[model samples]
Target: MKPSLASNRRTDRYQSKTACITGIVAAIEDQASRPNAAERNRSAGPIV
Candidate 1:
């Protein structure tokens, strides 16, 4: 069924905000661990 924009607006907005916050936190944590990472130059991040 096609979703109704009016009904989904609040839910979509909440999800978007939540996703942004989560992504930012994850990025910060990933960067924080960089100094100790054995291989910092890899695209996949520190190679354990």
Candidate 2:
């Protein structure tokens, strides 16, 4: 048995998208705890 080309392409795209989203989320979390994070917190409301 062999994997189809379309399925492989879809999997590659899904992995790439997941990686990009993970990177973005990590970057946001890292920045959200710094000094400027205060302003962000203020704008976002009580959730901070």
Candidate 3:
């Protein structure tokens, strides 16, 4: 079945919103982990 214009618009909007959210989440995750990774490496006391 062929989709209507309204349906196509809705699909486009959903995709755009999802992409925006995913980008925000990725940014937050990277920022949050940055400190933890540095601390772990410093405290590991030289990997054998």
Q: Where is model 3 poorest over a 10-residue stretch in terms of lDDT? A: 1-10
Model 2 over residues 1-48: C-alpha lDDT tens digits?
Answer: 234576777787777888899998987887776768768768898863
Model 2 segments more than 4 A misplaced = 1-7, 36-48
lDDT of 2: 0.76
* For every candidate, C-alpha RMSD to the true structure in Å: 6.7, 7.6, 9.4
- For all predicted structures, in order, the TM-scores are 0.56, 0.55, 0.56
Top model by lDDT, which number? Answer: 2
Off by over 4 Å in 3: 1-7, 36-48
Clashes of 3: 0
TM-score of 3: 0.56
For residue 15, model 2's alpha carbon misses the true position, in angstroms, by 0.2
**RMSD versus native structure for model 2:** 7.6
- The Cα RMSD of model 3 versus the native structure comes to 9.4
CA lDDT of each prediction against the hidden true structure: 0.71, 0.76, 0.75
2 or 3, which is superior by lDDT?
2
Cα deviation of 23, candidate 1, in Å: 0.5
